[model samples]
Target chain A: MSVKQQELEKSWQQYKTQQRKKNLYYAFLTVLSVVVFLAIWEAVVRFQLVNVRHLPAPTVIFQTFIEKLHSTVPDGNTLGQNVIASLQVSLTGFFFAVLIGVPLGLLMGWFEPFDSFVRPLFELLRPVPPIAWIPVVVVFLGIGLKAKATIIFLTVFVSCVINSYAGIKLTSRTHINLMKTFGAGTWETFFKVGVPSAMPMVFTGLRVSIGSAWSTLVAAEMLAAKAGLGYMLQVGRGVGDARIVVLAMVTIAALGATLSALLNTLEAHTLKWKEMR
Target chain B: MENIAEKNIDTRPIKVEVKNLTKSFGDLLVLDNLNFNIRQNEFVCVVGPTGCGKTTFLNCLTRILEPTSGDLLINGESADPKKHNLSFVFQEPSIFPWATVEKNIACGLEVKRVPKDEIERRVDRILDLMGLRDVRKAYPKDLSVSTAQRVIIGRSFAMQPDLLLMDEPYGQMDIKMRYYLEDEVIRLWKELGSTVVFITHNIEEAVYLAERVLILSNKPAGIKEEVIIDLPHPRDITDPKFIEYRNYITDQIKWW
Candidate 1:
């Protein structure tokens, strides 16, 4: 290559390297912040700055976590069992919500008659909290995993519907016009222009729906789940064992964060064409 | 309803006919008995006094609005998007950001369900002609606005529609880019052999790009005059005859 061409290639390599380094630095900073925060908590506990009875050290929580992984102990189920129970219930409800809500939302937004028919009912129920439906679910599903899952489904379904609906509403008129001029049928226009245009918002709804799943998971499990993190929390509270309570909290937080991270990865892949974050 | 792609190709002497087209918004008359005809395989530009119901006329032609009276006919059939192969390039770039340069150009073809091999062939040819081959796989977000506009124009042309309507597509571009785009359009029109109706406010642009210019009168509008440009291929903008035609059209526009 000519010298100028070589220079450009060299600069491009440098730019990539610089970008990689920047990302690594940000990651390192995040790790450092969490580590520093954990150290302070450990110090406070060790020095008796806080009541040990009320709050446990990170080491104690970690030991309890390890023990709970293998032993059911007071909660009558192991950590793995509780996690599995929680995942099954939450994911069932969450997936059902997405399946029913997303298409419902898309159709409602696109078809005027559908929107007219569904809007009144949707708006009427939107304000009532999902937890308020726990009694209704219990009456129907009898407080088993089914009842718990139904509660989560309710919590998640609204956001999925609302976001995807708004996303479709945000579909560009220019695009629809373009499709019409191209002699596209209504269905063709909806799939090609309306659906793709609504995706970013749909994904936004998905993220919101996933979050609602976790937030409602605990409450749903509290409605008499035999094995779940939320059940463990209630049992720990009943027996005045703050350690198990904190353990359940930590596990839930960690699992929720992991799911959120996975969702973020999916969003990045799907919306690669979106300009800027 | 017939699918445009599957429709047996039918050619009529006049590709488009506007017969006493009238449009009124409640009581305000926007278009008043507009009448015109665009011949098959012809390039026609429509110029009018600003806000002379030009957009209403276009909207009527595209069936975006129901005209108060009269009708537009394409190939001896009532104008319907599903019944005829038609393409439109809007005043602004309307490229789909989700699609790549190649997919964006192939959108019209895909809509009409053209054969996959045929779609690919036409897309590649247009991508080369439009100088979009290098960025064929790149999405619209990564491209410049002008590049995005090229994708739009390329898409409209790639369909090789029976009728192509463009509404001031270069309105937002600089004069230099506008001229470049205008030349590309003229070349595409010549090669694709589609009847084109371009709407522009610029008299010079109408003169430069059109074989026939239909100048419209002030609001409550109708065609004022028809100026058929009798110039050689690749006509010089700086040529004396070209300037004379431009001046004459400009005067006609002012009078209207």
Candidate 2:
């Protein structure tokens, strides 16, 4: 082979080997840390270092989680059913928030009159946390799916609007001028240049909104809901079952992480252009 | 130069007419009562010292910034972007970062809602012309500086615009890249047969590309001299006559 070709091959091989080593090291550390954490937790509770009443052993929580997966536990529904129920409510609220918030924010940022009318109200309600609306939502909408969804919707909507609006406002002037010079009308410019430019920020809003939606699930289900992971947590706490509480917390965290990962994948696919940067 | 002007007089129709064009930002006057007429299909380069409102002149011509007291007529009518087919290649790389090279070139035709087949034909032609056929699928961020600028130029030319305004599109490129792209631009100009108003501060570049060089004075800019570049295509910078034209224009723009 030529010297340059040989050098290129050597560099490629080095890069592959370095990548493989990094991946293996990361995997080893992750597994080791998880094993160590579980062993410490199990030992602490099994040996009575901490009261079992307060913190159950990892084994006990795992067993409870497995049992709950098949059999109806505190909420008369299996763990899978509870998870689906929570997902249904959160997804509905999240989707609705994205649908309304994105356009509203884009209009508010793009159109002066629309901003004047909606900005004041948005600012006023923005400082008030989504959780604070729980009492008011429950009082008016009653203890049902609508009430729960509304609470989650409010939580996700604010983030979506803020991000979308900022994205639209921050669009580069050069792009706008270029579009205008090409005989693009206002609406055409908005769709072609404005909307596409705002995509990165819109996806950021979607990611943040999904996170908020998951977090607000517990408070949304604080009402007298029959089937959901949040409801299971409430009942577990009411009856003082530490195993059930731990199981629900772990499931919530796992589910939230999985949903966020899914959203992240979608974001990467949609905004593949950003990867070039 | 006199012979070329006489030759242009026989067949060239006035493409753009600027009468008493003046622009000011409140107390800061930028362009002061400038008047010039550009012939159809003429490659005119506007050159001046730094911050001499060369960009302002282009912007006012496109009506992006309205002239304070003057009229700009394209084909005997007021210039309106909405009514006219016009395109601008900005000094900075203005290729849409979100779009691939092919899509960036197709943007103007897409906005105009041209037929799909024609848009495809134009985009393909431009990609080949700009020598971007290999990297047509690559986004702006992945390309080299000259490639990105080529995409911008190709986009403007793909529209087959009646008039194309370029604001120092090669300002940031190195000497070698600039020469290559300048040659590419001349090729495109010849093939497309569009009127071009190229703005730059470089006198050598102006002499190298333009049939007519419109030299402007320092700030609150007005026409200082109009130099007719009679050099043939593929001009040699080392040619004595080429250096003469370059030096003559350089003398016109020297503020010091």
Candidate 3:
């Protein structure tokens, strides 16, 4: 090969090696954080910072978690069944939240009159927490999937709407002006500029709302849940099985993290141009 | 297109007639009775001290800001694009961050309900002309200031508007890039021959680009003088006549 070609190949190899080293460095930092977190958790439980009766050790929790996963009750429902039930309620609520929130957000962002009109109403309802709506939701929908989902929906809706609105509004003034210069009518500009610009915010809201939905699942299930991780925790509390309660709590956290991570990946792929995490 | 030719072509020579165009922000007046006539196809550059209502004038032309009180005319009547197309190239590279360079350029076309294929074709041509063909699919974040500004100008030029208003579109660019772009804009003006009203604080830019440089006085701004450029196309900036005019405008502006 020519000297220039050989030099180019060598440089490219060096660049790739540097990139690999950077990736490895970041991976080590991430793993180190997890290890530190686990150590603190183990130390806290071992030192009896919280009563072992109420909060089991990490090892005990993991063992109990395995037992819960494998052990079947008389009804043949395993820990996974409970987790799936909780996930269903949260996912259902999240879907409804997005369905309702995105359009409302788009409306609020696109038209000034609507924004001024609807903004007050949303702000008024927003500060009222999702758990606060349990009674109202229970009264309206009764003790069923709908009621639980409604509680989760309320949890997710507020943030989703606010984020989506901010996303749309945050679109650069220059972009809006560019549309105006091109002879775009208001509606055309909304779809052409406002919607796409707000998409990143929409996803952000979705991620936040999904976590809220998952967190609210326990509270929602308290109303009329026959089977869910929240119900499992409630049952475990009744029998005073701290391990079961801890396991249930861990499962909730895991599910929330897992789903959020998945949604984050999806968001990254969808809004690849946005360069946002 | 020659300035005289442009003037004659605009049988209705007064495309924009600003009469007592006064603007104020509560107490301070930014523009005061700014009277001027811009003929169709005439490249008129307005140069003034910083914050001397150059942008305000363009905004007023675009209706982004409501003039406090003025009779602003376009094609002898109200400033409405239905009567005539109005386009603006802002100082900032206003390419939409979420959009590809092609999509940003097609924004105006999309609004006009032009056919998809036609939009694509025009966008391709404009991108190629602006030397943005390689980066057409790239987002604004990936592009340099010059490329981004070029995209902005390309977007405006694609509209094929009757009146093109530019607000220091090359202000963010380096001297070399600015000159190249200025030349490119001149080439575009000659090729498409659109009526342009350009705003700048730079005297050299005003002298370099416009057939007539309209000078505005400091705040509560109004036209102080109008210097007509008699130089031919691709005029030498280093020429004695160009330097003399630049110096003359500089002196007038320094005291204003």
- Candidate 1 C-alpha lDDT tens digits along B18-116: 898999999999999988888898899999888887777887888767899999999888898776888888886689999999999988898888999
> What lDDT does each candidate get?
0.88, 0.90, 0.83
Q: What is the TM-score of each candidate against the true structure?
A: 0.95, 0.94, 0.88
Please state the Cα-based DockQ of model 1 relative to the true two-chain complex: 0.66
CAPRI tier for the interface of model 1: medium
> Can you write out model 3's per-residue Cα lDDT over B22-96, one digit (the tens) per residue?
888899989888888887678999999998878887887777777889867877777764345778998866778
Measured against the true two-chain complex, the DockQ scores of the candidates, in the order shown, are 0.66, 0.70, 0.51
Candidate 3 yields a Cα-based lDDT of 0.83
Model 2 chain B worst lDDT run, 10 consecutive residues:
B1-10
Output the lDDT of residue A273, model 2: 81
lDDT computed for candidate 2: 0.90
Q: Model 3: what TM-score for its first chain?
A: 0.89
Q: By descending TM-score, how would the candidates be arranged? A: 1, 2, 3
Sliding window of 10 residues with minimal summed lDDT for model 1 chain A: A177-186
Q: What is the lDDT of residue B216 in candidate 1?
A: 91
Off by over 4 Å in 2: A1-36, A46-48, B1-10
Number of the candidate with higher TM-score, 2 or 3: 2
The residue pairs that clash in candidate 2, if any, are none
